[model samples]
Target: MPRSQAETPENETNSHAQKALSLDPWEAAYLRFETPEEEIQKFIGRLNRLGAPQWPRDAEIVELFCGRGNGLIALQRLGFTRIEGVDLSPRLLAQFKGSAKCTVADCRRLPFTDRSKDILIVQGGLHHLPALPGDLDQTFSEMQRALRKDGRVMFVEPWRTPFLTFVHLISEIPAVRRISRKMDAFASMTEYEIRTYEQWLGQPELIKKIARAHFVPVHEHVGWGKWNFVGTPR
Candidate 1:
């Protein structure tokens, strides 16, 4: 019998996902193998083109699911001040102590008041959302609610086309599949499921949801390096 979406085995106890975040294996592999100089330059170049620094230098910026403070650290170097980083990993947050104010929490239930931020940045966070069978729309609404009017949310997502192809190739690799299964087994919440979590993820529908939340797209750029989706609160 063919597997049904409703019958798909849950990997809420995956240990690898519990170790940090439920990272796209492709992105995780690239992060593990590629040089930071190459990745950072590629990221910054695209953001620079998109006017990612449009938020005032003194404005409060929040980096949701900011792992190890990489984005926050880099943004600080670029003149951003009063930055806050939030994530679920205590180990990751602990390493960021003194570098920035790091909060360990879930993005789905952000602990900030409405209209609390000037610029909200979410890098590879939303894909982690639809992984489970819970309230995705509500979570997006919460994110929208947290942003002040005129606030912007920037996301770097794997283009859906490429993500599908990547998943197909990786599923053929035995070792990778084995490791993925083990990780899925150790996950504690549906949030950590790696396979179904990654399948068919994209930004267009998400952009539409953002629109419903009273935001409008400022840009959608598919560059040689990465795809960026930027939206401003209405």
Candidate 2:
């Protein structure tokens, strides 16, 4: 039988996006090789520090944009059960659902009830949207509505300035350039959807949005110059 649309890789081109199709076995293996274990550990430790104290006891955790179930697996390893993974890709979600529960849907229009989960995680996923003024606030509000009282949302996003610079400097290498071009990746993106993201680039606008959504910033860490925000719903 022919591969399903969800099983086939689309004509995608981006330096970073190719790494996201964690559903493909060879592609997944390549990304695993590229991933820096030490850096990943440090990032997880940062998340651990911010989340440990506030983590609900065996609470229901929801991971949004859960590409390839990496974060879900990580949380499971960390002793969190009752986890639901949500993603936009059907193949990825299907693969994850084989061993765990997951849903395929948009984050803005979550299917679950309001304040249903104790923890929500968006890892390297939120920044994929068009960065614009007010867009972050909109996303934060939606996340808040999806969380229970005192629920927490953790996001790991590129820090814009440094991240862009780093990618630019390193992407010039022959291999990186080739991979990036093949992946249709750009060094930086300014989405036409929200001009607010343009003006607020590299700023704490994201944090401010979370705060406005009644989420208190409980922790922040800068690793590989990336920003990780850990906040609690008020």
Candidate 3:
């Protein structure tokens, strides 16, 4: 049976997620790898879908929780200029490459002024938020507040489908409880699990509804244990 709106997971929390040594512990994980080329193309396609004459090369963009700015490297190649990364750790920001400014800050509370940004991209970052509806909801509102008129937003979040969810639980058990949460086991696991809260696992519909509520959703794509959204800020 398909999950009804009422069946959407809510108030889900895991004590283990809070036990992370660094909230954004991606410093070690993304410190070395380049963003997947396929993903870069996917994002570039979505961005190109937005502006008319041609994809605006001068768009002021930021990637929230951008660990080491690896994804920004890919975005730069896609014709985006004035790209910046906002992260919480200076250590992670230090690893960033490409010609981009890096800011150490919280995603929920951005440092930009109202309507200061042309685009906001949260690539593989939303799932790390505190696993509560309120927390997710606030993050959405903050993203909305940061956008200029006609500004677009895109999020590439981890998805949790049933089999993937099971894989995620197994991975989380070993990675967080047993292995000290210092590495990315999901990268090593062949299973399609996305390391995120139960509410988000395999729940693309819920993710769509959440984004649509805060903005006018332009497109949504889900597959490979990931959910991607492109939207116009409302």
Candidate 4:
């Protein structure tokens, strides 16, 4: 997969390249690996912390890298109506069973017009990008461009905390993994994208710094092996 260039035009050529980059391992196993109810609960908690409950039901919202649309489902359950999703994998997007429009597009080059979206959300997706600061920075730039001046961005991604380290250590134990379905699934997922996962894990602070540079922080939480962030465009 090519490293995503900043402000790449949302054209047919770019779209094809982006789709080629979408050869994600999770695309094949995500449905089998995740428990939808549990995933939705996690998304609900994150969205609530981002003040989703206070937002109007008709607010325009888009979720990038929305694998299988669990986050979209959470937004729907919260009463959000004008919701949309974007991901590179068509197969994963096909699994989405919601009213929101789903598009196959690269996060680094969003299809939306400037200042057109009210809110942008990403859950457990950034860490999948192979390129660290570059791809991540490009994605953030695209996000800022696509969002309205007052638009908000929310994300929850894996963090390299002590608790996460401990979980990783224990997850290595076959017996422990067998006893915990969540752990087993997590282990399997991480193993599938270990290279990119480890790249993100080693630089949690850098990731936060990049995000902070793009948006002014409104809320931030780093714990439980996750970095939850909410911000408005700078």
Q: What are the lDDT figures for the candidates, one per model?
A: 0.64, 0.63, 0.68, 0.87
Please write out the lDDT profile of model 3 over residues 110-175, one tens digit for every residue.
Answer: 898888998888877777665646667888888899899889888877675565556555655653
Instruction: State the local distance difference test value for candidate 4.
Output: 0.87
Tens-digit lDDT track for model 2 on 70-103? 6676666666668888877775565453355888
The TM-score leader among the candidates is 4
Which 10 residues in a row give candidate 3 its minimum summed lDDT? 11-20
Question: Would you list the clashing residue pairs of candidate 4?
Answer: none
- TM-score per model over all chains: 0.67, 0.68, 0.69, 0.86
- In model 3, pairs of residues that clash are 160-201, 160-202, 161-202
TM-score of 1: 0.67
- lDDT winner: 4
Error of 3 at 207 (Å): 3.5
Give residue 207's lDDT in candidate 4 (0 to 100): 91
Worst 10 contiguous positions by lDDT, candidate 1: 182-191
Native-vs-model 2 lDDT? 0.63
Off by over 4 Å in 2: 1-46, 161-164, 175-207, 210-212
